[model samples]
Target: MKKNTYLLPILRTAYESLTKSEKRIADCISADVTTFIGMGIAEIADRTDSSEITVNRFCKKLGFAGLQALKLALASVPSEEVISEEGFAKEDSYQHIAEKIFQNIQNGLADTLSLLDYDAVEEAVEALLAARRIVVFGVGNSATICQDFETRFLRFGSIVEAYSDVHQQATVASLLSAEDVVVAISHSGATREVLDTTAIGKAAGATVISITSRMGSPLAKLSDIVLIGMGREVRYRSEATASRLVHMAIIDILYTGIALRRKDYAANIAKMRTVIRVRKQ
Candidate 1:
């Protein structure tokens, strides 16, 4: 796979989960990427006061093949293009706040794209397309996303449903068959209700696809395909709020991908438009 251009964003996104020694290495690189790129694995290990094996493991965690690949990828990044993750301050004017919000969303989307695995997305589209039924589950803020997914695909002539209530989700999951697909959306990927419903769906032999921020979360573990996105937190704003856009962006991707592959896409959309036109008249 081609390397992503946004190296620092990837590092920033993964920084919280790194081990102490791994963090030391990450700090050294993020602090001075230009100088760090010139150094070898042994040199990086020595600089970080860690071992070569630790360095290799750190590289793997960042999706690099090894130190050389990491260096090459980092070197490929244009020095002038840096991501600014700063949030708006309380004293900022309304205009400034709007600009900051736009920039944050822009950077967040790029960061998510950097972490995205296209192969996994393609797999998800295929699963959704072939499924006998598609059941979507989410709760709280995510429930809105589930509803959005349901509405988008429903227009494309797909047998899809979205459930926000835990009981309804469970009931839908219980009746799923091998040919069904379950899509679970959670920002933290630890939503208990979502997890339980997804588990039920999996138990009944349905394929599970999860869109979440954390790769190691239980929701990801339960999924047949995991699509991870990033959302940075700013003061006064929750990460979940930021991640909603990211999750919806992924949904857009899936919606477009599936729509493209469906033979009746144009016809289905045209029929829906015709029906809506009658109400407008």
Candidate 2:
């Protein structure tokens, strides 16, 4: 994680959609973030030729709580040389491309870890543990993550299912009860099918846990527990590509937490090991 790592990527990602005033602020900060970091909200507004309210709005648009949160993020950034591995180039060597991909994943993981709420994660774990049935909803790349979740939790003898088909997801969601849990994964947090299905699950009295990058997105709004991730896009990679690993890491955390809390966890693992040994022959 370099200085302004997440900040710079965020500015780039949100630049086009920003209002004129917000763009001015983004430009000022992008031009010289170090100087901007030293300024207060009023000072920033003055520097960008915008109002204090606009400055605050800009910060929130970029996913921070306010200008103060943005400032803290900037202040925390350590000054370092921007490496070419941050972006890809036709002239880059194979090793360089690999390094760039690895760097992006590392930065994304670090960003998500920084924003993770342990209490929310624990809450999600508890929901899964108590769930009579765990149904995961996802689409596209997210569907793969849903499958991963099912594969991991099913080993513990949990009644888990991952649904990628929109129709099936909606059907299952409609039938769920308070004893069920729905784990929804979406990078943008605004996928229509995911939101729709999750809403059904929510309406059915099931616990809804959302893993998403956008906290203010509709999916997050529908969720009972929200786990936010910082998944900035790389040059050629979509935001989903960057977010996939972060989501998987969160799943891993939840899986381990639930596994550890289970009284029969050791016995389950021992039985699984014996089964594997017998199957190998």
Candidate 3:
């Protein structure tokens, strides 16, 4: 785990890889991390119905040296940073469901904001400003976000394109030069098409920027600058829901930064408005 890695996400990501007993421990800890913070190895073992040895093994799997180390890491995470997966219950009232949904969104945004590295964000804005052409790539829900970014960048009168098709992305990447930039958006950061496109862009000398939740993901490794978003998966909603909101927020930050740097940004906006008005007439 990297510095400031949230415990709940780590447990969730590693859940599939753990043994049945280890999974029980993971579930117990993830459900209420604050409660687990005060627990000893013996207490955890009892809760999970496993031995102390099994609990130790589970801790090691999550990159902790021991139960003590794991607890320390969990303790470091602020209470607000822990994302609780509150699955929708069929027995719940409509108002209850609405409140839970709003709470999840609030937590997701706050977590992403906390995880953002402003230095990386500044570098990303500089790269965008310097590039002669910018190409954005994503698929599925991420592609929708890429398109939104493309639309936003157009206000700056820069050469930008968003490609959802894998073949188009490859072709665009093949033509990229050192003067170009590529922004790849992937929540998992392990999407095959997005990774391949990013690799091509890098090989062609374009500066690659990755927006992902996973810190040490393949996409992050390939990027010249990485903007991390902390979005947790919820059982009743699409996995990308919170991540998409974070991604949009990041895009807005970049858009604002780039707009501020351009001398004629206001003039460009006026011209765009005038053009729209003329078309309406």
Candidate 4:
């Protein structure tokens, strides 16, 4: 079995670089791993006799948002055990390959959920809900995700459009206004067509939101709000496979949030269902 590792290993690796006070915080967590997960930041700080800032800094050192994100990542360790046991291996049996693929997808979802910032998600939801027209820009695998996003929003009665071709994306983006919202989906955050369309959207004064893996990529740089997806890309998997799953998860979050906030969303869903049922009949 492969070793099950998560946030603890990251803390251990960064232990030497930490300040003496931060090391105390790390030591406290290392000593009582279970207790650390349930404890609040203030509680942990008090226990370690360190300021909350130090605790926050310690989490950032390990590439987390703060204490809450660190706890979320720590809470996912049990699932890592499942992933370890079902890890992909060369010459594996068909059953093993199936199990491994399923486990990897589960792990990716868990990681993406843990890494997501709820505030950013809420902001994205609000922007989508308030937009006069919603435009989604993507290409390749990311374009498929954009289509799903557009379809879901349209079901809720939003004026939404998705464009995969660069020319169409650019034309639509150029027509957007301040009241419009543009969601750009690119797993690598560097797709030229997506980037170009996003730039045009921004130049037109639309609120540009990006769903991507890189925080510092061009898409993110041009975006008004950046929603990050899982960055783990397996060598054996095709481009954007795992990332697309994460993107779809984010889309679901946005759709659910928006639906709940809309006044007649439930009625709209019921009406849509009835129409579909009639069409099938």
Candidate 5:
């Protein structure tokens, strides 16, 4: 009941030990426990073509008393929180819409923290730290993501160059070399501009780091290393807000890592004085 945190890992272990039919139910439950949690033993059994008794045994194997305890654990399972525009749209008011969107933003931030892969992030830090120059490439809506990464990297004393324009990004890619590091970002991993630009960097022998979604995507395949940005996606959503959050989360991790490593990067950044000085004079 209170062992849901330990449940998945144990299930994964049991799954490794399971017989063929038992593994079927484990696979179904593991795929999306949220849905499985809401479903009944009979319903799930019917769906998976397994028996209720088999499902109960699978549950007991994972240290649950029975299926009911497993269901309760699933019910208590903390799902990723996201704001739904469609749900808010039904409310039909501007204020309500605003509130829901903000909630989604908050939830997106939370979800980002929940799914962040620290090991991959540490590798990214080492990449940025080890690179002679860092070139960030993104296009269209993702171009803004590139700029954000550039800003954060620049603050850490890395020579970061970012391009949102396709032509300029292409030109920047041409200057890339093995001594350089390139981070290409695309939520779908299908942006032609980003893919093409990253290809140029890769061809020039720069270490390629792809921040993308699908594991088997082209960009993912091309990367020397990747930081997978996974999130709970909602239907008909803009993707902009969630994708930006994904980009920012990685940048934030890199920023914090670099700042910690250099120790003085933050202080140096804080010393910048604005040009508005002589007002009293």
Candidate 6:
């Protein structure tokens, strides 16, 4: 749904009235607009740390028949980006498509910004900074995202395990310690393999960070850190386009944030590599 729509305005107003904890719920709603728009109030409360009373108050404050009415209102608008038979990534009209990409990119970034628990991000980064290994887990598209994550972390001199196979992921997750961290990516938050891997990671006393689309998903509940994508952008079916891109964009931002935080050390490491390059030459 576009920002200019009916539900968006009331939700924004109600959002301003939220307390710290209530704001958490609001953040999740903004992160995955479609999911929240369709979800039950109890689910929202469970994810956001709000009680039934507060949830009702929050809904009333938004001028709904409590929560279901709110959901129906949100559901009224088409959730996907109705592109004119052209996907956002096509290069045929480079400039026009570039602008659209910027829009989606900005929306994805907004989804991250609105929902990101900065403290959690910091905690996850701290773990990575101090860890002996930064293992990554996910299934399907998330595995591709994990591979990209492993690539980025390796650039910072961190050891990485990027596992696409469930058995392989479980095997490595089994070996992690409290000094290690697993960054798990799952769009649905219900991926059995990723859930299993993260469960193993948790049981092994390792920190877990979940990147997923739904805040109330099982993966989020299990994770120490949750990074959500509010990409109800693909309205119609169970397609994997917009939301996945949103997840990767968050990863990119996180990767950039980590790299910038360690920029000086990374630069020094690069400078040291120059001597080795020259010697080889």
Most lDDT-accurate candidate: 1
Model 5 pairs in collision = 83-104
Task: Name the top TM-score candidate.
Answer: 1
Give the per-residue lDDT digits (tens) of candidate 3, residues 179-228. Answer: 99999999888899999989999999999998987765778878999897
lDDT of each: 0.87, 0.82, 0.85, 0.78, 0.70, 0.71
lDDT of 6 by residue, 199-262 (tens): 9999999988888876557887799887766453433335545567777777777777777788
Instruction: Give lDDT: candidate 6, residue 214.
Output: 65
Worst 10 residues of 2 by lDDT: 77-86
Instruction: Provide the RMSD of all predictions against the true structure, rounded to 1 decimal.
Output: 2.4, 3.9, 4.5, 8.3, 7.8, 9.3
Better of 3 and 6 by lDDT: 3
TM for candidate 5 is 0.67
Instruction: In model 6, state the lDDT of residue 83.
Output: 24
lDDT for position 25 in model 5: 84
Q: Over the stretch 1-281, how does candidate 2's per-residue lDDT look in tens digits? A: 22244566556435655789999998898678788988888888887889999998988877788887888777665566232225667899999878777777787777676667688998999999999999999999999999999999987889999999999999999999999999999987889999999999999999999998765677877899988775555667664576798899999999999988999988988988899999899
Evaluated at residue 210, the lDDT of candidate 5 is: 84
Off by over 4 Å in 3: 1-73, 79-81, 91-93
Which regions in candidate 5 have their CA more than 4 angstroms from the true location? Answer: 1-91, 230-239, 274-281
Q: List residue ranges in candidate 1 displaced over 4 A.
A: 1-5, 40-43, 46-50
Residue-level lDDT of model 1, residues 127-170, one tens digit each, is: 99999999999999999999999999997778999999999999
List pairs with backbone clashes in candidate 3: none
Candidate 6: C-alpha lDDT: 0.71
TM-score per prediction, in order, is 0.88, 0.83, 0.77, 0.71, 0.67, 0.63
Candidate 2: residue 189 Cα off by (Å): 1.1
Tens digits of per-residue lDDT, candidate 4, 52-128, equal: 99999887766777788788777866533322323356788999777666666676676566556677888899899
